[model samples]
Every structure is written in structure tokens, then in C-alpha cells.
Target chain A: MTSRSALLVLADGRFPAGGHAHSGGAEAAVRAGRVKDAAGLESFCRGRLHTTGLTSAALAAAAAYGLDPAALDAAADARTPSPALRAVARRLGRQLMRAARATWPSPRLDALAAMYPRGAHQPVVLGTTALAAGLDAEDAAYCVAYETVGGPATAVVRLLGLDPYQATAVLARLVPEMDQVAERAAAAARQGIDALPAASAPLLDLTAEQHAAWPVRLFAS
Target chain B: MDRVSLRATARIVADADGGLPLLVSDGPLALRRTRAAGPYTRVTVVGAMSAPLGGDRLAVETEVRDGARLLVDSAAATLALPGRSAEPAAYDVRITVGEEGVLRWLPEQLVSVQGSDLRMRTVVELAPTARLVLREEQILGRHGEPPGTLVTRLTVRRAGRPLLDQELAFGPGASGGWDGGAVLGGHRATGQLLVVEPGFAEKPVEPRLLGENGAVSPLAGPAALVSVVAPDALAVRRLLDAALAELAPF
Candidate 1:
């Protein structure tokens, strides 16, 4: 049997909030000759968990562990140099805050919402929401880790190139890294987002650039 | 009483003799090329059609056969003529990507000038194990022009699960005027993009430089979709078409 709390966390599509609309750049990668199929997807997801997912996980843990909302926001923003990434972080954060506040009420969450006008990022908002929900710091880390990779998998399946099983398998393979990233992300949260290290992936960025020019497209930036 | 409609349909046959792209590996980059500017190759419409000058609602559809690649490009910047609320203009694009087939459906940008009510929708369906690369961009108001209220809805799905869907409604400063941070962010230009990587959803690839006035996010999965609403529709369209060609033969 699953805990009602945890069930709501995963079962609700809104929990991921506008995640359905994003490809995590899967479309871009497949289009660019990088990711081909299940094998390629697995390789890509693992890499993300190690790099971007790792960074995002840390930020999420920090948010859960009670990091300064302003500091976390700036840190996540600065670390994600790509304007597209930055926009995504904020867009997810802003919308998440709106929904979290409505569903799970908390004063701390309110304080975080106030911070958005000042440019708060999604991970930080997510962290505050986790804290309000009484979730442990680890939960935040895991959620971020899972989300960073999970999003693209869903998008790919929706795009009709991979089976649901193949995408889930990719997630399952990342479990080990998910554990490792949880630890590292939690530990890094102590040092703050600025001190955190990041390995930027270039292929994703190129695909995003290419996708931005279509006359008739399916996603919103 | 005057009414207008423009429809474009194209079919691509792979191995149509060796051609550009120099890549012939199960790639059928069949395309319908329409001249939009000076000294460019042009394809005539098979039948029923009318000149598209913005404001006029335009509809487009493209299909790729299994093991084929379809590439579609346009001639010039699509301008939306200003119209009253009761007589707004619209444009529609429908597409299908078959199994092991590739479709790079990239066209020019849509420029929405002042007093123009433009409605556009794009629907895409992908087969099981199919692949596609697409691009799209929109300019709210062109050349520092004031952008009044705008409406647009876009949808993409595979096996009937929504991958990306967007709905935007705004008027010249919907967020309490242009200076409001709630809207525009004072950037004057906006864009949405999709990069479809079928297998790798959360894969983090490096962001690419698309040129000035453009930005790229990290790679997400096997398929990525983006919406880029920018300042000058012309500049964005020019950038997108060139990029899609390089992403070919399929």
C-alpha cells in the first residue's frame, strides 16, 4: 500500500504542473542526431542525472532543507546560464507556487511566493513547498532528480517514438545515481548554489535553438 | 462579402534521385518548396489557393510516409493584416509523422501587427516509434510596434497523450501595462521551442547558439517542443528555416 501523501505527489499530473508541455529537449536531441531510441535515451537520462539532474536535485534539497529563498533563486538562475533554462526554472517555479499555495497552505510558502517578484527559481519554490508539506530534505532531492529526467521521458512517449516501458526503464536505471545525487545534492545545499559545480551539456542547447525557429510548434517557452 | 482560404499539402518520396543534404540513409526528404523572396525555387499550388498576406487565415498540412523524410519551407514573412474583433484572421497547420519517418515542418514566422486578431493552431500526430524535428516562432508586435491583445493555441500529442499544449491571451500590456513585470519582462521578444528526442526525456544536452535575439534551453528527452514568441517575425523565420535544413536528410 502507498502512503496517501506520496501517492498524491506522483499520481497528480498537476504535481509536475505544466510538465506535460515540455520535452526536456528530447525532441531537439532526437532531431539533432544525438538520441536515437531506448538505448540512447538511457544513456542521455543517466548523463542528466549525473549533471543537470544532479545540480537540480541539490537545489531542490537545499530548498527543502530551508535554504534562503532569495539565495537559492539567484543561485539556480546564475548556474543555469541559458536563458531558456532560466525561463523554464522560473516558469515552473512560478506556476508551482501558485498551485502549491492553493492546495497545501503554509505561511512559509507565502513568504516564498512574495520572493518570486524578486526573481525566485522553481527548485527553491519546490523546496519551500516540500518543507510546508512536511517532507524531508531527501524527498526534495529525489523529487528533483526524478523530475529532471522523468519530464523528457514523458515528452518522448507523447511524441510517439518510445514505449512507456522503455522510458520507465530509463528511470529505473537511474535509481543508483538518484541515491548518490540525493546525498551530493543535500551536502551541496550546505555550501549554497553558487559554490556548486555544474557540467553544462551543449547538444541540448543546440536542439533548443533549432526548435525555436519553427513556424508551427507545439510547446511554449 | 469576401472570404479567403489557403491550403498547402505536400508529399515527400525518398530516393527521389540523389539531391541536396548529401545524406541518403533511409531518408526521404520530400518537400514542397514555395518561393518567398528574390531568386528562389518556387512550387506552384496544385489547385485552390489565394495569396497570403498576414491577416488572411492560412492552413497547412504535411505527412511523411514510413521510412521517409519531409522538409517544408516557405518564401517570406507571413504578415497578419489588422482586422476588427468580429472579423479576426487565422492560420492552421496539421501534420503527421509515421513510423521510422521524419518530418522537419519549419516555416516562416507570423508577424502580428497592431489591431490584428490572429488565431493559429497546429496539431501533430506521431506513429509508434516515429521521429520528427520541428520549429516555430511568433512575434507579438513587429519592429517596436505595440502589440495589442493576442490569442494563440498549439497542441502536440503521441498515442493521444498531450506532450505540449499552449494557450496565450494578452493585450498591449495585459499585466497592468507594458512596464508590468508580470508580462514581457521588458524583453520585447519571446519564443517557444520544441526539440523531440524520443527516448531521452531528461537528457541534458548543451544549449546551442542560434544567433542574436534567440535562446536555447538544455535537451530534455527524445522529443522537445518549443514556442519562441519574439520581436521581429522575419528575423526568427530566416533563422529557423536554415537550421532545419542542417538537421536533415531525415
Candidate 2:
């Protein structure tokens, strides 16, 4: 049986994967007055959960399912419209590769690192790392789906100085939808790469590009 | 279901003296080719319908031969209306550019009226040395009308390798996420311009906010994709014109 603790270890916010520097676009939303309180935060999380969250989860699941890593990486590149986000993904992936190699050594993981010395997409690396850790595709999907909201949630707390409990409550309220998105993502993995979801948030993409050009910003992107 | 299909191709041939470039095309798709001051052949649409109805299917195929340059444009905007059918209208476009060839496609705006649904897919294949400048514009609805459905997908490949693939879905009940402040931010008109060239350098261009609501950003690739969302079609056109002036080579 796969170790249940592996999921926890991977999902922990303090895994030291360099995800802390990114706000997942929450910083931009908060600055624009789109997300002020817990209520608006929940709405923002829900929107991201269905679009970018779902897309990332499916990519992780596909990687965990033992699909070709290079193909999955290409798909991830295609799905990401903003160059800024793409750079962030690769940076995170490189960081995750270091942690994963030390935590759970595997030939596949080593091969992936060698192939993409610059680093593959983060979700792809996360999925492959989950595979190396004796976990399944669904487990990897759950980790990614949760992080999709968790990253932004933490960012909002820092950016707007909102109540931590209220932000936690926003994530708690999204548990049901998150589970649904994770399940759909894992199922889509079995259907092949072409069948994967391409749902996109154009505003998020535009804002990401805009945010990258900013001379001053708290988060990387 | 009423369906419309168009197939068109453009090639460069030797002139009577075998000196200047002569543009030739075939197929039912309308073509009004004119020689510009430059080496590019300007092809404008003629005898085509102004709008598409429900269940309408359109297919346009174009090719630019080696050492040839072509530009495509339409006389007016393409307005999609709800037809008598139960499903949405469809448009499929395929384009191929040969070695050292250039193609510039700047179609007019596609406005979706109330109760209208339109699905469009464009696939482009290019040689390693080919150059392309393509633009797409969309208006959700007529002023004061409810928004309709529009799903657009673009895939570009060079030497059999994918360079860019993007899909956008907008309309009612499609995905509220797209309408969120972080996404489209409640804008009605949107435009995209893609420029792909060999040995191109990344330009440090910031996303500029046009008028009250429009903004443009340059994406990554040998291609630079500029997207803008505005309050209206005229505003979007102005934003696109400015962006194209900065990004487009020809």
C-alpha cells in the first residue's frame, strides 16, 4: 500500500519548494480591489479552482499515470499562456526536484531532472515526485488541487492583512468543489493528453503578464 | 442545417516577363488580390456573407508558396446570429507557409449577437524560416444586448513542432471564472495579435492600458501574442492598431 503520510508531506505548505514567493495572481486581484474580504476571496478561489486549478491537477495526474514526461511538459507549456507563469513554474520545478531527489530517490526522477536541467513544469515534477514516493495519480491530483487555492490564500493573508482564520475558512468552504475537481482531473488523465481540460482564465493570463513587467511587486507572480 | 464551406489557396508565379511576382488563387472563397507597394500581395474578401447563422460551417484553407508574401483581410465585421438550428455555428481554418514565405492575416471583428453560439478553430503550419502576423478580434454582443457564446482555439506549429496552442471560451454559463475580475475583468470586446518570425529578439514591451478598460500584453515564443479587452469594438480596434504597430513586422 502507498504511504498516506507521503501525501501530507507533499501537500504541506512548508515543503520548501519555493512556492512561497508566488501569489497565484491574488496580489494583483487584491490590489485591484477585486478581493477584499473572505467572501470575495472565496469567489476568487472558486473561479481559480475550476479553471487553472483543474488544468494543473489533470497535468499532475497525467504525470503520475506514467505518461511521457516530455510530452506532459510540452502540454503544460501550451496550457500556460503567460511567459511569466511559465518561468515561475520552471523555477518551482527546479526547487521541487532538489527536495524530491533528497527525500525520495528514483531513477525516473533522476532521468527527468537530467532531461530538463532547467526544470520541467511544477505540476509535472510534483506528479513524478508523487510517483517516486509510492503514491498514486489521485493523490498527486489532490495535492495540486489543494495547492492551487492554498498558495493564493496564504498570499492574500500577507497582502491584505486579512484574518488568517477567515482565509482558512474560505479554503474549508471550497473542500467539496476541490474534491470534485481533483476527481475529474484524475479521471481525465486516463483519457489521454489531448482530452485534458484547457479551461483558461484570460484575465489571470493578462494580469500575470502585466504583473511580471511591474517595477515593484511583493510577489514574483 | 444550413452550412457554408469555402476553400481558398494563394500562390506566387512568374509574371509575363518572369520578373515580378504574380499572385494566383483558386476555390469558392472570395479573393481580391492587389499588389501593395511592398512585395506582399494583399487579398481582400469579396462576395462573402456579413454574418454566420446557426449550424453554419465554414472552412478556409490558405497557402503561401516559397519566397511569396500574402495578406488577408475582410471588408466588414463578421456578425454571428442565432439561426434556425439548435446548435452553434462552426468555423475551421487551416493555413500553411512554405520556406521563406510570409503571411499576414488580419480579419475583421467577429461579433456574436444575442442567442448566438460560434466555435472557431485555426491551425497553422509553418516552415522553419516562415514568418506570420495574425490577428483575431471578437465583440461579445451589440451594445446593450446579452452576451453570446464564442469558443476559439489556435494552434501553431513549425517544422512539425508545436510553438503555441491557446483556447479561450467566453459566454453565459460557460465558465464564470472567465468573467472574474482576475480574468477578462468584465470586458466586452477582446483582440489578439500573434507575430512569429525567425531570429526574433524578445522586446521589453509593457502591457499598456488603452482607453478606459483595454490592455495589451506580449506573450512568450518565437511568436509574441498581444491580447486586449476593451469596453467596445471601436476601443478594441484602436488598442489593436496600437499593439500591431508595435509588434507586427508588416
Candidate 3:
């Protein structure tokens, strides 16, 4: 049996990955006045958790299920509409690959790094890393689903100066939905890549594109 | 379960004297060539029934052979009406372009009336040297009526490799709504234009936010995908045309 701690190690906020630079669209949302305080942050996170968050969880789960890495990468590229978001995904993937290789020391991980020297998509790398760590698809899904909201919650605390306690409470309230999303994602991963969810948030896509053009910004994307 | 299946192919055949290109098509879908002042052949949708009702299935398949240049246009906008059966309406479009082939498809807007449920899928396969310029616009509902449900999926591939894949769902509450959480963000009309070709370059274009909201971004294959959202169809069209002008010669 795979130790559950493996998931903790991968999902840790300070996993030495490049996630800190990204606000997960929180920067954009904050600039547009969509996320002013803790309540608005919850609404934003909920919208994201159901849409892009669910999509990422399913992709990670499928990767952990041992699907073809190249195909999953292509699907990831297809599902993401914004070029700016894609660039961030690849950059983070490259960073995660470096950390995963040192921590897990798996041949598959090495091969994937060599295949995509520039970088693979982040969720693809995360899922494969979970596989390398001997975790199941649901574990991988939970890790990504949590990070999807966690990263943004931390960013909101910095961007809006919201109370850290309030932000933590927001995440606490979302735990049940996050678990449901992860469960559905793992279930879909078993079916096939075609069955994966294509839920998209157009406002996020548009705002991300707009954010990329900004001259100065706190977060990368 | 009856469907209005339509299939058509456009190929350039060498003339007896090998001088001018001849365009030929065979299917229920009509093809009327226009004397447009351009290097490409302009074909208008003349005879085919364009509107689709609930539970109605419609398909249009087109192929452009090597060295052929075809431009397709619709005479009027397509209105998706409420289904007669329990299931929603469905439309599928498949297009293929051969080597050195160029295709430009500019169809009119698709309006989804209230209580209507429509699913539309479009797939485009292109050869290595082929180029495609496609445009699609959708309106939520008629004047002063709540919008219906619309699910659209578009996939583009070159040489068996995926270039662009996008799926959008719009309408009531969770899938979409006028609230800030909705995909449309309270916009009633939305449009997208895709330009794909070899050695495509990204150009700098100013954002169009005066009358409508829009953005243009480069895709993985060096192509460009432009999206525009407006309060009405006219605004969306104006914004789309402005964006397309910046990335023209597709």
C-alpha cells in the first residue's frame, strides 16, 4: 500500500515548485474588483474549483492512471485556451520536473524531462510524479484540486491583505466541494481521456490574456 | 430520429487546356460560386436549409483538394429553434484541406432561441501546407427573451497533430448566465475567429473595448485565436471584423 504521506509531500505549498509566482488568476480577479475581500475570494475560488480546477484534477488523475503522457500533454494543450496560461503551465511543469526528479528519482520522470526539455504541462508532470511516488489516481486528483484553490487563497491574502485566518476559513468551507471534485475527476480518469470534463471559464481566459499584456503585475499569471 | 445530413466536397480540377481551375462539389449542400474580386473562389450557401430545430441533426462536410482555394459564406443567419423531441438539436461539421489548399469559411451568426438546446461540433483536418481562416459567432437569444443552452466544440489539427481544441457552454445558471460568474460575463453575443497557416507570425493589435470587449492571443502552432463579446450582434461583428483586420491575409 502506498503511504498517504506521499501526497502530503507533493501537495505541500512549499514543494520548491514555481507556484509562488502565480496567483492562479487571483491577480487579474483582484484588479478587476471581482475579489475584494474574503467573501469575494470564496466566490472566485468556487467558480474556479468547479471549472478549471476540476479540469486540471481530471488530467492529473488520468496521468496517474498511466495513460500515454504525450497524449495527455496534447489534451492539456487543447483544453487550455489562453496562451499566457499555457506558458505558465509549461514553466511550472519544468520547475516541478526538476524537484520531482530529485525527490522521486524515477526513470519515467527522467524520460519525460528529456522528451520535453522545454517543459511539459504542469498537471501532466504532477500526475506522473504521483505515479512515481506510488500513489493512486484519487490521491493525485486531490493534490491538484487542493492546489488549484490553495495557491489562489494564499495569493489573495497577499493581494488584498485579507486576514490569513479568514482565507483559511474560506478554504475550510470549500473542503467538501474539493473532495467531490477530486472524486469525480478520478472516476472520469478511469473512463478515458475523451470522457474528461471540458468545463471552461471564459472570463478567466479573457482576463488572463489581458493580464499578460500588463506592463507591471505582482503575479506572473 | 431523422437528421438532415449534408455532405459536400470542393476540388480543383485541371482544365483540358490546363489554364483555369474548375471547382466541383457533389452533395445536398449547395455551392454557388460568386464573381468576387479575389484570388479565391467565393461560394455562397444558396439551397441548403440552414435552420435547425430541437432533435434535428445536421452535418456539413467539405474537402478542398490540392492547389484549391475556396471561400464559403452563408446567405443568412441560422436560428436554432426548440426541439420537437426530448433531446436537443445537434450539428456536426467536418472539413479537410489538402496540400497547398486554402479555405476561408465565414458563416453568419447562430442565434439560440429560448428553451432551445443545441450541440455543435466542428473538426478541421489540414495538410502540412494548408491554410484555414474560419469564423463563428453566436447570439444568446432574440430581443427581450432569456437565452437557451448552447454547447460548441471546435478542434483543429494539422498532419494528425492537434493544433487547437476548445469547448464552450452557454445559457442558464451553472452552464452559463448573465451573472459575473458566467462565461459570457453578461454579454449576449460572442464570436471567435481562428487563423492557422505555416510560418504564421503574431502581430501587435490594440484591444477593442470601446463598443465591445475582445482579445487576440497566439495559439501553439503560431496561429491566432481572436475572441469578442458584445452586448449585441452588431457590436460583436464590428469588434470581430476589427480584430480580423489586424491578422489578415490568412
Candidate 4:
């Protein structure tokens, strides 16, 4: 059986994967006036959960399912159209590779680090890390799906000085939908890498590129 | 249910005078070769009848051989209207650019009317040295009504490698949150411009924000992609037109 604690460790906000530096486009949305208060954050998070969130979860699950990492990496590149977002994924992947290798000491993670050097996509690395941690595809999916929204929620509180309770409550209300999204992602991974979701969030993509050009910003992406 | 099936093909090869050597069109898609100032060959797609309603299958294929430059555009915007049949309409566009060849595909907008469902896919194959400038504009709904259902997938490959492949869905029946804060954000008009140039291999374009609603960034390959979302078709075109002029690297 997989270690349940490993799953929590992977999903914890304090995983030290360099995720805190990025707001997953939340910083840009706030500047655009698209997300202001707790309610606005919930709407923004919901939109992200279904589009890029679902797509990232599926990739993580496929990686955990033992799909070819190189192929999954290419697929991740295809699914992400914005160059700014692509850079962010690779940066996070590199960081996660370091932590996962030290914690789990797996040959698979070592080989992946050698192959990418810089890093593979974060979702792909997350999946391999899940494997090293003795977790399953569903666990990996849950970790990624939650992070997809969790990163932004945590950042929004700091960016707007919103109530921490309100932010936690927003995530609480989305538990049911997040669970469904995670389940769907894991099931799709069983089909194959080609079966992964390619949903696009145009506004997020646009805002990310816009955010990358910002001279002053709170988050990396 | 009976559905209309139309398959159109256009072929072009370099001629002695840099003209079109072979051009073909069939079905409701009539290809009209128009004269332009440049040495490149230009063609316009003139719709012979109202088409692409529900249960309809339409395909357009174009090939630009080596040493040839071709430009293609449509006469007017294509409307996706509800039909008697419940099945969704399908439109497939395939384009191939040979070595050192160039292609410019600037089709008109595709409007998704209420109660209609349409699925469109565009696939492009380019040789290592080939160049391409393609634009896609989509309007979710008319003036006051809500959009129906529209789904589009674009797969572009350069030298047998994926450059950009994405799928977008809008209106009813799409996954939840498409119109929410992070997705469209209640915008009804959206589009993208993709320009692949060999020049970018030496020096990639810097990421830049276009006006307020759009942005341009370099892809992994020797190309650039500009994405835009606006409140109306006019605004979308304005941003995309400006982007195309600034970013199109021949």
C-alpha cells in the first residue's frame, strides 16, 4: 500500500518546491481587476481548476502511471502555449527534482534530472516524485489539482491582505469539485498520455504573458 | 439524418514566372485566384452556399510546394447556425508547406450562433525552412444573444516536432469555468496569431504586451504566438491586425 503521509507531504503548501514564488497568474488577474475580494478569488480559482488545473493533474497522473517521461514532457510543452508559463513549469520541475531526489533517493529521479539538466515540466516531475514516494496516480493528481488553486489562494491573501479564514473557506467550498477533477484526471491517465486533457484558459494565458513583461511584480508567474 | 459533406482541395507549385502552377477547388468552396502586387500567389475562398450547419462535415486541404509562396483568405465570416439535426458540425483544415515555401492563411472570423454546435480543427505541417503566418478569430455570439457551442483545436508541427497544439471550448456544453474569471472572463471575442520564421532561430522575439488585452511570446521553436481576447469582433481584429503587422516575420 502507498503511504498516505507521503501524499500529504507532497500536497503540503510548505513542500519547498519553489511554488510560493509563483502565483499561477493570480497576481496578473488581480491587477486586471478580474479578481479583487474573497468571492472574486473563488471565481478565479474555480476557472483555473477546470482548465489548466485539469490539464496539469492529468499530466501528473500519467507520469505517476509510468508513462515515458520524455513523451509526457513533450505533451506538456504542447499543452502549454505561453512561453512564460513554460519557463515557470521547468523552473519548478528543477526545484522539485532536487527535493524529491534527496527525500526518496530513486534512480528514476536521478535519470530524469540527468536527462533534463535544467528540468522537465513540474507535473511530470511531480508524477515521478509520487512514484518514488510510494504514492499512486490518484495521489499525484490530487496534489497537482490542489496546488493549481492552492498556490494562487495563498498568494492572493498576501497580495490583497484578504482574510486568511476567507481564503481557507474558499478552498473548503471547492473540495467536492476538486475531488471530481482529480478523479477525472487519474482516470484519463489510465487511457494513455494522448488521452490527457488539453483545456485552454485564454485569459490566464494572456495575462501570464502580460505578467512576464511586468517590470515590477509580486510573483514570478 | 442527412448531412452535407464537402471536401475542397487547393494545390500550388512554383511556376517559371513565380505564378500558381496548379490550383484546384471543388464543392461549395470555390477558389478564386486574385492578383496581388507581390510575386506571391493569392487565393480567396468564396462560399457558394450557406453551409456547415449541424450534422455537416466540411474539409479544406491546401498544399504549397517548394519554391512557392501562397496567400489565402475568405470572402466573409462563416456562421455556425443551428440545424434540424442535433449532431455537431465538423470542419477540418489541413495545410502543408514544403521546404523553403511560405504560406499565409488569414481566414475570416467564425461566428458561433446560439443553439448551434461546431467543432473545427486545423493541422499544419512545415518543413525545416518553411515559413507560415496563420490567424484564427472566433466570435462567441452575436450582438445580444449567448453563444451556442464551439470547439477548436490547432496542431502545428515544424520538421516533425510539435510547436504549438491547443484546444479551446466555449459557450454551453463546454467544461465548467470556461467563461469564469481565469478563462474568458466574460469576453465574447478571441483569436490568435502564429508566425513561424527561420529568422527567429537566431534571435527570438521578446515577450511584449499588446495594448492592454493581448500579448506576444516566442515559442520553443523558431516562431511567435500572439494571444488576444476582446469584448467584440472589431476589438479582436484591431489587436490581431496590429500584432500581425508587428510580429509577422517573413
Clashing pairs in 3: B54-B83
Please say which candidate is ahead in TM-score: 2 or 3. 2
Which scores higher on DockQ, 1 or 2?
2
Best candidate (score: lDDT): 4
Report per-candidate DockQ.
Answer: 0.05, 0.44, 0.38, 0.69
Error of model 4, residue B31, in angstroms = 2.7
User: Candidate 1: lDDT of A123?
Assistant: 76
In Å, candidate 3's interface RMSD is 3.4
The DockQ assigned to candidate 3 is: 0.38
List, residue by residue over B154-183, the lDDT tens digit for candidate 4.
888899887888888988978777787799
Q: Pick the DockQ winner.
A: 4
| lDDT for each residue of candidate 3 in A1-221, tens digit (9 for 90 to 100) | 67789889999999999898899988888887777888788878877887788889999999999998898898888778678889889999999999999999998899889999989999999999999999989999999889988988999999989999999999999899899989999999999987777666667778887788889999998
lDDT of each: 0.57, 0.78, 0.78, 0.87
The prediction achieving the highest TM-score against the true structure is: 4
Tens-place lDDT digits, model 2, residues B164-235: 777777787465456666556667888877788775644445545554444554344466677777778887
Worst lDDT 10-window in candidate 3 chain B: B11-20
B223, model 2: CA deviation in Å? 1.7
Task: Put down candidate 3 lDDT per residue, B1-250, tens digits, no spaces.
Answer: 2544333443333222222355454443455666653767676765444446677666766777777777778777778777556677777878888888888888888898888888988889989888888999989899878878888888888888777777777776342122343255567888889887676734433332323277776676757788776788998788778767767665
B6-91 per-residue lDDT for model 1 (tens digits): 33333333321212222111111123444432321223222222223334555555555565555555555455655433545566
The runs of at least 3 residues in candidate 4 whose Cα sits more than 4 Å from the true structure, single-residue gaps closed, are B1-27
| Better by DockQ, candidate 3 or 2 | 2
